[model samples]
Target: MLGKAWQFARRHKTKIAAVSAITGGLVLAGKLAESKFKQWQEEETRKMLEQIKKQHHYENTEKTSNETLKSLFPALIKTIEKSLDSEPILERIKNQTGNKIELWNELKVLSFARALAMIITGTQLVLLLKLQLNILSGILYIKQPSQVLSSRLQERFMALSQNFISFSVPKICEQIREKMIQLLALSLKEKFTITQLEAFFQTTLLQLDLPGFQKLIIAPDGDHISQPLNPDEHLLLDDLINNIVELLEHEDYAKIFRIGLQTSLSNVFDYLAESYLSHESYKENGLRSEVRLPVAKLIPILNQSITVYQSVLHALIKHYTIREYSANIYESFCQAPPDAIAKPSLSTLWPF
Candidate 1:
């Protein structure tokens, strides 16, 4: 049997070898195909996960940016709220200048320019506050009266709005004036010598253009045309300054200013409240339930006020010191400047 099988195997050896080789090749091909398929699947999965991760990161970054922009205005309001209180300003002045007597001496002459600034600031603040209150009341009563906020809630909000306004108006005015002074100082091309500064002050003091100033403050488009003061208005301005200087000499000048500021603030608030908050619906008799105001709602109103006030303040400052008018002063400051050898002391930009 072995001999017969051997002889058969030898006779068909080539065919048998061919069949064995074909089977081995098929198994190897199958294994290679499986390995390639696994590699392809892994690559596809990695790409998909990476794509998703990138999308998520982009979305998060965009959301963060939007949130930051949204918060900026409110943050400004909060900063003003925290920093510009009457108490803080008074304390700061006291700490800087010590006694009222010291303050009086330091401020005696310096207060003239500052007095002009204060007068303008006080007037503008009152107008801005009224405008802000009106807009806020409009939003509460007209725009979002029903949706998100109920009418009853609107009335409650109005009632509480005064406290916010009363607290904020004075502080905001101070903050703005502080910014105005800083900006004015920074915008100058160079430091002024005492002689040049005094000359500049004398030249420009009475020449402040009221019509031009008012135009800049109220105009939507910022027009900073350098305007000169007329003879009559110059006299009036002089008188005003004189009156302020006389008032400053009084021992209770600070107290008087505070009282006047508070009075003006109250009057503006009262006028606006009468106009906006006197809703016919609020007069109707009903069970008076208290409405709680969300801080979120108040922010938008405050932000609007801040925006308007800031813009106006900037406009006024630029108008007050437009390069066209200021060039004369600048030229004087620059031409044939004092020798460094003779005057060893540094020339101060601010006179006071």
Candidate 2:
């Protein structure tokens, strides 16, 4: 059967070749046509995209110019009003200069002058808007100039507010401290002797159990100086009490008290100075300098406040420690000493 089929195929070989050639040609033509259609579609899409981009650019330019005109309109109106009023000044000048210019002639001249000024002002506004629009669209890809301008204005306003706050907080803190000192003095009827106050502060610091109280210097990172006391540590409590008592015994205790407090106050003053000076310099020079205005003003104030807050907490702890230690010592010492008593129990011997 295979031999007979091969013989029949060979007998119609010419006809088979004709059909195969026609089918292959049709397939090749179809592929070429499809390729051309695809290229045409891509070219059409590109043209459409270019057209859309051009239209968008035109609209942006138009919108930018319109906004510029709107912003300038009020100022332009005011200028015109001022120029019209200046007719009197111009006439007075003419009279004073002995130019023999009539008031009515001057009025007509001022009217023409005001109109010309308005036209010139309008043209200038349009030109400025055009330039800004071109710059934003070409360089910055900003579709709306007004939005960009508004954002810039808002940022400047915020910076100004931050600068004000940074400078004012230190003065405010100083005033509060003064008031507190006065109140403390008033509450204590008896004059606080330097020695007695020193004792009081020493006792307080001992009771607070705060770390880094004896260290006069603060670290730049602030974290090392501001850590809180460990409540579970009995040794910390004893050291805190001992230091407070020692401090109280010092003759110049008032001057040297609250080491952390002094560090904090110094930090605050330094910060305020840095912030104010930077703000002033920024106004004088500009923001284009090596020292960024925000950095110069913001960093100092933030770091100062953080250190100050830590110092304040440490000072409070010291105050409480002193008071508690004083109370305990007074209670224990109210009676005879353990050695003086005939037979003291272990509990009575260590009145901790």
Q: What is the C-alpha RMSD of each candidate to the true structure, in Å?
A: 27.7, 33.9
Q: Candidate 1, overall lDDT?
A: 0.36
- Per residue, candidate 2 scores C-alpha lDDT tens digits across 114-197 of 332332223322322332333233322322424222343323322221222233222332332333233332221232332343
lDDT of 2 at 158: 21
List, residue by residue over 158-271, the lDDT tens digit for candidate 1: 222233333433444454444433333321124333233334434432354422333223212112223444565445334323322332333332333333344433333233
Give the Å shift of residue 3 in candidate 2.
6.7
Q: Report the number of the highest-lDDT candidate.
A: 2
lDDT of model 1 at position 25: 97
Off by over 4 Å in 1: 73-352
